[model samples]
Target: MHPLSLRSARLRLVAVAAAVLATLAAGLTGAAGAQAAQGCEVDYHVQHQWPGGFTANVTVHNLGDPIDGWDVEWDWPEAQRVAHGWNAAFTATGDRVNAEHLSYNKAIATGGSVSFGFNGTWAGVNRDPFAFRLNGRTCDGTVGEPTTTPTTPPPTGGESAMDQVAAMQPGWNVGNTLDALGGETAWGNPLITEELLAHVKSQGFNSIRLPVTWEEYMGPGPGYAVDPARMDRVEQVVDWALEQDLQVLLNVHHDSWMWLNELGTDHDAVLAKYEALWTQIADRFKDHPAELAFESVNEPQFTGAEGAAGDALTEELNLVFHEIVRGSGGGNDDRLLVLPTLVTNADQPRLDALKATIDGLDDPMVAATIHFYGFWPFSVNIAGFTSYDAEVEADLVGTFQRVHDTFVDAGVPVIMGEWAVLNYDHNRPGVHQSGELLKFFEAVGFHARDKGVTTMLWDAGQFLNRATLHWRDQHMYEYFASGVTTRSGTASFDSVYLPSTGAITAKSLTLHRNGLEFQGLWHGGTRLAEGADYTVSGDTLTFTAAALTRLAGNRAYGVNATVEARFSAGVPWRVKVVTADAPVLSSATGPSASFAIPTQFKGDTLATMEAKYADGTNAGTATWTSYQEFWSNFRPDYAAGTLVLTPEFLAAVTDGQPVTLTFHFYSGATASYTITESGGTVTGTA
Candidate 1:
């Protein structure tokens, strides 16, 4: 989604009413003094209620610096007793309630939050609790007044708005094809048809986030009329989605014309176009059912050199969009409008900025939306391989956590407007590749559900084959349909590529206790004929002497294979193996360092250099262009760019000390140079 900057571990996971009730904790509600510090903020949402029962979601945010742990206490103005809670230990004494962070959630980094919810019984009235205290400190800021839960039933509107949003099924974005740079077919995907919508629905996605750009379809100046034909096309798509019983979110996407620094250059003109655009859109959809929503903008950015000034301007523009839409009359008054952050970034700062900018806005139906493509190395299916590592889990949780703390905890609903991991060859031999993918989705989905944040999967015909009207990856489809709780023990091998000849044995294959041992080997999606193509012994698969030759004899992308095993249940295991070859720098080279390229960059052309000092200071950088220059000046010295110690950088190098130089290759392969400086010369090894 081209979020301006993802920053770092900038998110936290939140639990929504759907899953909140499932994780209720049983404990004593702690007590705190009125003098408790004022940094903690709480948002108590009564998600659903019955004759004598109700469910509530509470988020406790640490607004100050990082804290090792946190405790939140509150007194119910109404008679309410906690039944159970999740993510924290909870207790209720009379009308007072208290909660403490769980082991994993104890250390809340500054501006981060943890959430918990519970089911309770209220005899007289079911009102929200206020005057919350964190770690013996009173929460000072006024977040928002509680809104009554909607009266709609199970499938729609019978619960709180948050609950209804939480109930939204997995979503899919009809990406690049519809949100194509030029037009629907510009991106090589066929025009949108009802069949595609039905197929998507059949796959279990109940919501669709249509990314559309209106600038190209609009006329010039004042009344920036979105062309009638384009409007019809959009309406047609929306109608198709609605017909499929899918909730649709439509936005003024990539409208750089009016959204790009309009607040700084021609404020009134930009505002006029924005309002004019929304005026038409709001009026057009005013009669549409509540299933359709309007997003003000997509990835709004102000790069006119004004910096934060542009952010302020964009914020003002968002306010205008909200006002115009709400004032458009009809159902517009109750329509849900999503406000994108300055750059639609999910980083803590951007989220905080968004929260601050939209503060005090009277629209309770509005949600703050942001796109997440964080930790591309793992989250993205680059090179058809990615890690579901601890780092990825940590980053995902931290990033979502901040979003929950900043907006969701403040009474503003948050939406992960776009998120997805490409569908690749997830059927690797030993590791549960499909299972891992499901876990990733489930992790994000569960947190999103718990936080009342809806996630829309971004699909630009990457995972789904639009022309064929089928999913390119059925495992991914199954995972989405089955939800995260479904158990599977699918495993992927350490490597799927076999050499021209010889045995390709999987090393240290992670085995589940009582799990079914390796039963068969499949190559190119076909089970290799037993004893002819390969032989299996214990955990090893020995390709017969000529198996590799026969498999890849004429294949273009080479042959792929996976070893299969079955397990009664799912279990977590860690099996470490040295996979990628580290780049080597020849010590013989002086001033210029030569490198042994990793396998990932075997035939790739470009390379980029990123340098930094010991203290994390920028040293210098060179883009892909420098790769050619390096080779032209010094031919065939290993591969790609050879870092030549120029006087500028040499001067900064301390004698006999090491400076880290990172090289980024075009193939997503990365290596580092541990260079040591000696008098008048530089030499290093990677």
Candidate 2:
């Protein structure tokens, strides 16, 4: 429905996965030998280690020239036993372990590397393997590194990974351009510019995700090198984003060859190219700031018929991707890496596969992501007026809630990576449905916020016109923005029925006072102008014949708010604000008379003060706590007015002077008042 050819892609993926399974089942390992002219090297990284067990990732770089197949042999001084491995077949003889390339990963391009990992056990020492032989002869160059530690930490100021993800909520995705079928401009969307990225930042989005397809520009193996000009283009875009101070996610996308399920294709050659592509990518961006995140794949689906087999293979690929990025060194070691489930679906079974894959792995910088689109009815089946109702609301909330309970609540941060309601149904371009569609958009935004998941709206020349640089649907943007910021609540709607063709008059419309504010009025997605379309006499509205026509058919012209509420006739509504229930300062001592003001009331203005001194003038100064200290240090003294304990005042009450102090607060009206402690505790008054 969203035009990605879902059925065709899924079918192809399944077919490929099935074929790969068959090949592996046949235990096909290519010719193995060590060669002097092969010019091979290895990057051996110890991912994690314990007293008795260790996990290691080995990448064999074929630096010499293109070869059909190769073998890697390593000797362990410790009595280490290879428990299991992926991407290569492993066999042991005493202290030597030989890993032969699998049927799908045999070929090694000139500069490409074939990587695999194994879970091994050691009695006392888990030493790094120093001697590595490729084919039969010793590797020509020195092994790059034996540990996975980075030279520097991520640029998150010590914030937890989930905290970083949470801060990126309300992000925007630059979809359909970079991730287009052909190239950045192939999807008919204009080439993205720095101005466009800046505009997105100005609209309150703090992050941008750029999905690029690179296979089209990459050369055939030995190295499978990406075209330098193409890479330069990608870097330029990333630079624009970094200039805007926005977090960026660069990912592989839309490469039909690497889609995982292409049956009958050379699986090994395909994987070799995939690995080579990432090798060049990781090395190029290894020096970038931690703000740049790398997502392994857009949506990895297994190639086989069985879902379980697909899940397992998908997990292995994900792990390999993680290892490559981390092993590339530099800032990449601590950079954020996002992993996607099969087909990018958040169904329970897919999530189980993800959990199983990540069960034992220990990487705090990694996060899991999934896409959200109501698969059948809402995502594709478009209808007007009735589509955005309770059922749709439940669906949005339920999907997010399930993901939260499974991944978020369990400590892993989850991202609602790509989500959007279609702007227009292809066949019905003239139809008006923004009113109900806005409702659905708001539901998704608020639901994601409540579930502690970050949502990146997929804006692909949909609501926002790329050429015109204007919002095509103003109401939709408004609703989506409100949902991201507003506290959880429902909108207050007032309905007015009109005849088919006649003037209409209605009495006053009132709304609930529960943090709900009147936003606007709409009928069948068409907004009714305030003065031209209808005249409001106080709370009463008188509509013209044209307005009646536009609002007829029981379509319901209604007033709306960020949150839902009940309409009334003449009742006044007050927006809910945070206020202290009790006194912030009960008592204080020393040279100055000090009192406390709650953090929530920091924005409240100080109206007036009444002071009656025991003797001399009562004068003092007031200061506000710093913004950073307010949240960080928990020193909640913002409006705590301090009175100077002058010698005269102290003399008047020699033993313990008691000076009366009263504080008044005001906005346009006298909002509230509080009494400060004179010489003893005085409760606040509001």
Candidate number with greatest lDDT? 1
Which of the numbered candidates is closest to the native, going by highest TM-score?
Answer: 1
* Candidate 1 C-alpha error for residue 177, in Å: 3.2
lDDT of 2 by residue, 79-113 (tens): 77775444555667777788876555778877888
Q: Which stretches of candidate 1 lie over 4 Å from their true place?
A: 1-159, 257-259, 305-307, 377-386, 421-443, 449-451, 483-506, 509-561, 564-686
What would the per-residue lDDT of candidate 1 be over residues 230-318, giving only the tens digit for each residue? 88999999988876667799987777544655656766877788888888898889989777888888888765733466567768878
The lDDT for every candidate, in the order shown, is 0.58, 0.57
List, in order, the clash count of every candidate structure: 43, 21
Flag regions of model 2 displaced more than 4 Å.
Answer: 1-156, 256-259, 263-266, 304-306, 382-386, 422-432, 487-497, 502-686
Model 2 TM-score is 0.52
